[model samples]
Target: MIQRPLYINKLLGFKDKQLIKIVTGIRRCGKSTLFEMYQEELLKKGVFKQQIQSINLEDPLYRDLINWEKLYDYINAHLVDDKMNYVFIDEIQNVADFQKAADGLFIKKNVDLYLTGSNSNIQSGQWATLLSGRYVQIHVFPLSFKEYSSALSSDNKFEKFKQYLENSSFPYVLNLNNDKKQIYDYLGGIYSTVVLKDVIANKKIRDINRLESVIKFMTDNIGNISSIKKISDTMVSEGLKILPVTIENYINALCDSYILYKANRYDVKGKRLLKTLDKYYLVDIGLRYYLLGNTKTDKGRILENIIYLELLRRGYNVYVGKNGDKEIDFIAESIDGTEYYQVAETVRDPLTLKRELSSLDLVRDHNPKFLLTQDFEPNTSHNGIKQINIIDWLLE
Candidate 1:
C-alpha cells in the first residue's frame, strides 16, 4: 500500500484520545487499507497485537453480530484488562444502532475507538445526538497528485499527471500498470457499488435512470455554477421529466454519498455566504472521465476541479467567491485565514493574464492571493498576489 502520511499522522495525533475517530469517504477510496497501515504503525510503537481488536462489519463472519447489543457484547467480551484496547470497526453503519455500541465502547476507559464509513450519514442523525462532541471525524479522499506521483517510477511529472487524470486516483489503480481497459473496469465496479448500494438503496430512490442522469450532468459540469432549476430544465429539455424538487433531492443524495461536493457562494464584499449559484466538484476526476468519456475535455474547468479537491485536502473550507460582479475561482478559508485562488489552463496571453488577475484585484484585502495555471514558468508575483505552476504547487 502507498503510505498516506497525511491521514496516518492525523490518526496518530488522536491515538489514545477519549474521542472516537471516524474515517469517511466514497467506497473503494482506501479506508480499509488506511486502517491496516495505521495498525502497522501501532505495532512498531510496541502496541500489543492482543490489545487491538479490528473488525470489518462488512465481512460475513460478523453477520450474526449486526445488532447493537450483540456487537457491543462481542467486543466487550474480548477486551484485555489493564491495557489500552485499540478498537477499529470498518463500515460501522452496517450494524443497526451502531452509535449505541460506540457510546458503550467510549465509556470504557480502556478502549480507544476508531470507525470507517462510506457515507456522510454516519456523522449525522442519531449518531450526532448520541455522541455529541465526544467524537472527531477524519474524512478520507482519493489519492492527491502528490500521492499519485509518488507511486509511479517515472520522473516526468507532467506526463504522469496526465496519466493520473485519465487513469484514476483510487490507490488500487496504481497496480494496473496504466492499462486503460482495466482501469475503466475497476472504476466501473466502484461506480456501480457507490451508486447502487450507497446511493440508490441507502436513499431509497426508485429511479436509477434519473439518478444516473443527474450524476452524468453533474459530472459533465464540475466547475460551473449550477442550481437545481438549471439542472432540472436541462434534463427536461433532454427528454427526462425530472422536477426541480426531485433533482434537488438527488443532488443531496449524491453529495451525501461523497460522489459530489457542493461549494456554496461566498460574497467577499458582503462577508456572508450566499444561498444561490453553488458550484459542485467531483470527488475524483477519474470518475468524471469514466462517466463522461473524453469528449467534454474542458481543460480549464478540469484544472479548477483538481484545485478544489486539493484545497479541501489541505484543510480549507473552499467556496466560490462573489465580489460584486467579478468572480474568484476559490476562496479557501481555514484556521490560518482566507486565501484567494484563480485557475486557468494557461496565462501566456497578455489579455488572458489580465482578465484572470482582474477578479483578485477587486478584493481589496491583505489576505494571500494566488493565480494558478498550467504554464511552465518561474514563479512570479503580481503585486501582492502570487502566480504558480499548478503541478509544482501540487507537489509542494
Candidate 2:
C-alpha cells in the first residue's frame, strides 16, 4: 500500500480532539483506504481491535441498522470499557439521522468518533444544524502526482507524469494495467454513480437531461470564467432549455457532490472578492475526459485543472487572482506566506511567456510568484518570478 502521509499526519494530529473526525470526498478517492490505514496505526499503537467499532453503513450485513436508534444501540453496546473507544463509520449518510447518532456518540468522554461520506449533505442540512462546529471536516482528495508515481513504481518520471495526467489521480488506477479503455470504464462508472446517487437523487433534481447538458458545458469549459447565466445561455444555444436558476442549483449540487469545485475571483488591487465569474474545475481530469471525451486543444486548461487540485491538496486557500484586467491562474495563500501562480502548456513562444508572466509582474508584492509550464528549458527562475516545469513543480 502507498501510505498517504499527509492524511495519516492529519489523523495523528486530530486523534483525540473533542471534534468529530468527519472525512468527506468523492467516492473511491481512497477515503475508505485512509480509514483502514488509520485503523492499522491505532492497532499498532496497542489499541485493541475489540475497542474499535468499525462499521460500513452500506454493507449488506448492516441493512437492519439503517436508523439512529439501531446504530446508536450497536455503538452504545461497544462502549463497554472505560478506555477511549474509537468508532469508524463508512458512508454514514446511509443511516437516517446519522448526525444525531454521531453527535450522541462523542458526548461520552470515553468515545472518540469518525465518519466518512461521499455527499456534502452530511456536512450540511440536518448534520450541520445538529453538529454545527463540533466536527472537523477533512476533505480527502485523489492521489497526487507524487503519490501516484510511488504506486506506479516506474523508473521514468516523464512516463509517470503522462500517465497521471491522462488517466487521473484515483488510487485504483494504480492496480490496473496500462489500458486506456479500462481506465475510462472505471472512471465512467464512478462518474455515473456520483451523478446519479449523490447529485440527482440526493438533491431531488427532476431534469436529468438538462443537468447532464450543463455538466457537458462545464466539462468542456474548464478553467474559464463562467456563470449560471452564461451556462444557461450556452445550453439554450445548443437546443437545451435550461433556466439560469436551474443551472445555478444544479451546478451547486454537483459541487456539493464533489464532482466539481468552483474557484471564485479575488481582485488584488481592489482588495475584495468577486461574486460572479468563477471557474469550475472537475474533481478528476480522467472522470472529466471519460464524461466528455478528451480533446487535444483543451490540454492547457486540463493542466490548469491539475495544478488547481494540487494546490488544494497542499492546504492552500487558492483563488483566481484578478490583477486589473489580467488574470493570474492562481493566488495561493497560507499562514506562512502567499504565492502567485500562472500555468501554461509551454513557454516555447516568447509571446506566450510574456502573456503568462504579465499578471505576476504587475503585482507589486514581494511574495513568491511562479510561472509553471511543460517547457524543459533551464530558465527555472525569471526576473523576479520563477519559471518552473509543471512536472517538476508537482513533484516538488
Candidate 3:
C-alpha cells in the first residue's frame, strides 16, 4: 500500500483534538483511504479495535440511520464502556442534520470525531453556522506527483512526470495501466456523479443543459480569467441563452461540490482584491480531459491548473495577481512569505521565454519569483527570475 504521509501525518497531528477533523475533496480522491490508514495507525499505536467506530452511512446496512438522531444513537451504541473511542463517519453528508449529530458526539469526553465527505457544504453556509470554529478541514486532493511517481516501473523522473500529466493525479487511474478508454470511462462516471447527484440534485437546478454548457466552457478555459458576464456572452454567441446570474449559480454549485476551484483576482499594485474576474481550475486534471476530450490545444493552461493544485497542496492561499497591464499566473501567499509564478509548457523559444518572464519582471517584490516549464535547459534563470523544470519542481 502507498503510504500518503502528507495526509496521514496531518490526521496524526490532530488525533483526539477538540476540533473535528473534516476531510473534503473530489469524489474518490482517497478520503476514505486516508481514514483506513488512520485506523491502521491507531492499531499500530496499541489502540484497541473496539474503541474505533467506523460508520459508512452510504452502506445499505446503515441506510436506516440517515437522520441525525438515529445516527447519533447508532454511534452511541457502539461506544465501549470507559474507553477512548475514535468515531469515523464516511459520507457523513448522507445523514440529514448531520451537524447536530456531530455536535453531540463532539461534546463526548471519550469520543474523537472524524468525518469525510465529497461535498464542500460541510465546510460552508448552514453547516458553517452550526459548527463555527469547532472543525478543522483537511482537504484531500488526488495523488501528488511524488506519490504518483513512486508506483512507476522505473526511476526515470521525466517518464514518471509525462505519465503523471497523462495519467493524472487521481489515485484509481494508477491501476488502469494507461488504458485510455477505461480511464476516461472511470473519470466520466465521477464527473457525471458530481454533476448529477452532488450539484444538480442537491442544488435543484432545473436547467441541466445550461449548467453543462457552463462546465464545458470553464473546463476548456482553465487558468483564463472568467466572469459571469463573459461566460453568458460567450454562451449566447454560441446560441445558448444562459444568463449571467444563472452562470454564477452553476459555477457556485460546481465549486461547492469540489469539482472546480475558483481563484479570485488580486490587484498587487493596489494591494487589494478584485472580485470581478476569477479563474476556475478543476480538482483533477483527468476530469477535464475526460469531460472536454481534448488536451492538445491548451497545454500551458493545463500546466497552470496543475501548478494551481500544487500550490494548494503546499499550503498556500493562491490567487491570480494582476499588476497594471501584466498578469502573474499565480500569486501564492503563505504565512512566511509570498511567491509569484508563471507557468508555461516550454520557455525554450526566445520570444516565448520573454513573454513568460515579462510579468514576473513587472512585480516589484523581493520575494522569490518562478517560471515553471516542462523543457529543461542549463541556463534556466534570468533577470532575477528562476526557471525550474516543472517535473523537478513537482518532485521537490
Best by TM-score: 1
Candidates 1 and 2 compared by TM-score, better number: 1
Ranking by TM-score: 1, 2, 3
TM-score for candidate 2, residues paired by index: 0.96
Worst 10 residues of 2 by lDDT: 119-128
Candidate 2's residue-wise lDDT over 29-122, tens digit each? Answer: 9988899999999999999888888898879998888889999998898775768888999998888878778878888888889988876666
Tell me, by lDDT, which candidate is best.
1
Candidate 1's error at 170, in angstroms?
0.8
Q: Stretches of candidate 1 above 4 Å error?
A: 123-126
Q: In model 3, which runs have C-alpha deviations exceeding 4 angstroms?
A: none
Global Cα lDDT for candidate 1: 0.91
348 Cα displacement, candidate 3 (Å):
1.8
**Model 2 lDDT vs. the true structure?**
0.87
Relative to the true structure, candidate 1 reaches a TM of 0.98
Model 2 clash number: 0
Q: Between prediction 1 and prediction 3, which has the larger lDDT?
A: 1
Give the worst 10-residue stretch by lDDT in candidate 1: 119-128
- Candidate 3, lDDT over the whole model: 0.86
- When sorted by lDDT, best at the front, the candidate numbers are 1, 2, 3
Residue 89 lDDT, candidate 2, scale 0-100 = 92
